[model samples]
Target: MEWQVWLSIAGITLSTFLARSTLLVAGSRLRLPPRVESALRFAPACALAAIVLPDLAYVQGVLQFDLHNARLLAGVVATVFFALTRSMTGTIGLGMCAYWALRYLAGP
Candidate 1:
């Protein structure tokens, strides 16, 4: 609502756009060694794990492992599906469906 807040938002938007676009533009022209290219491929997997690990390990303000925790089970199933199918959208859809089905069958 204030001028400072609006300025801060605009600054952040411009910075983020520049940061991402710079990488996209540079990546096409940049050539790396084979080892570096191979290593860079793991970045996405590590980042995805970092983001997903917390959610899979936590639920309902508490951490517990039980059949009642359908999300954790569904995550495992989804991981296996991803490994086998190597499809992002399919894995996500199947994982979500598994979670909902387990939740429904187990009753809330």
Candidate 2:
């Protein structure tokens, strides 16, 4: 719609492309130290926790860990599913179902 918007879009696109390309190019030739490689194995789980924990544990700008917090309860159930079955689909489906069931049971 405007020159500034176009420029901003271009800048973001170029930056993203460069950043990802750098990672790909370097990944082909670079060998991480053994210690670093081992540590990197946890990166995915750490990142997932970083993203999901907030939504699971917080509500309306407050931390909620009580029985009324459906998300917390569902997250625990999903974690158990993952631990036992290692199934992503089962985790998500069961977690959402658990959350909805709890929410309904907690009725207004």
Candidate 3:
């Protein structure tokens, strides 16, 4: 509704597009050193843990821990499965299935 708001939105959209384009162009053309390539391989694992760990530890806007918390148990099982199988798809599918089953079984 306001000119300032429209300008701010345009600025944000332009900045976001530029930032992503820069990364894509640089990442494709530039040859990363071996050390950098090795470190980049761990980025996905670290990012996944950073996102999942907090959810497993919290629920419904409150901190909780008990047998009823299925996410925590499922995460442990998933971690073990990942260690043993080393299959990303299998680990994720098993973890999701385990979480759903536990949640259903633990229903109030």
Candidate 4:
């Protein structure tokens, strides 16, 4: 709609492309320390937890840790189910079912 907005978007796209391409172009020559390589393996899981944990722990900008919090309850159930069965699909299915059941049972 505006020249400034288009310029900003173009700048961002160019910067992002250059940053990502630099990594791939030099990745073969780049060497990371064993410790850093090992630590980087956890980055994905840490990033996922950083995103998902907050949503499961908070509701409407408020921290909820009680039984009435269906999300929190379902998260716990899912965690236990994962620990026991180690099935990603089953954990997700059970978690959704648990959340829905809790909400339905609690009523509107």
Candidate 5:
């Protein structure tokens, strides 16, 4: 790799470290508003959905939302399972089982 690429990587690493650590280091002194804190509580779920939704919704570079899409169907099943049981472990297990079963049933 070129020296410029190495330097850029080092800079990015340092900046990311500082950005993340600053919050923890100054957390005791920082006071967020109640509304902001409440909103921040949902950030994890929002981030997760942003990352996972696209993968479940898209297949072969196309958007799919029908019964033919195994991932989408598995996600729906997992969602319902989670909603009914409130168990993260069960949700993941059932989701993977559903996905595998759907894929196997679809055949090649």
Candidate 6:
């Protein structure tokens, strides 16, 4: 609402926009090394695992590997589905279903 706050918000917005546009402009002509490009392709999956794995595998700061741990159960199901089907969508769907089913039927 104040001038300083408005200026700060505008500055942040402009900075982000300019940074993104600069990358986009440069990316049009940029060609990464094959190894670097291949490595970059794993970034999203690795980042997602980093964020999601702890929650799924931990409970109150402890590792949860028992049957009562619905997340762990779901993760196992998802892992198997991934190995067998090799389908990301199917793995996610089956994993969520397994998690919710275990939660409701077994009582977390």
Give the per-residue Cα lDDT of candidate 3 at 24.
85
In candidate 4, what residue range of length 10 has the lowest lDDT sum? Answer: 19-28
- Which stretches in model 5 have alpha-carbon errors above 4 Å? 2-12, 26-35
lDDT of candidate 4 over 1-108, digit per residue (tens): 599999999999999999879879887799989999899989999989999888998989999878889999999999999999999999999999999999999999
lDDT of 2 by residue, 30-85 (tens): 88789998999999999899999998889787999887899999999999999999
lDDT by candidate, in order shown: 0.89, 0.92, 0.90, 0.94, 0.96, 0.88
The sequence of per-residue lDDT tens digits that candidate 3 reaches over residues 1-108 is: 599999999999999989778778777777889999899989999989899888898988677777778988898989999999999999999999999999889876
Question: For model 6, where is the 10-residue window of minimal lDDT?
Answer: 19-28
Candidate 5 structure quality by residue, lDDT tens digits, 1-108: 699999999999999989889899887799989999899989999999999999999998899989999999999999999999999999999999999999999998
Q: List the residue pairs that clash in candidate 4.
A: none
Task: Estimate the lDDT of model 6.
Answer: 0.88
TM-score of 3: 0.59
TM-score, cand. 5: 0.71
Q: Which model, 3 or 6, shows the larger TM-score? A: 3
Question: TM-scores across all candidates?
Answer: 0.60, 0.70, 0.59, 0.72, 0.71, 0.53
Distance from true location, Cα of 90 in model 1, Å: 3.3
State the local distance difference test value for candidate 3. Answer: 0.90
Candidate with maximal lDDT: 5
Candidate number with greatest TM-score: 4
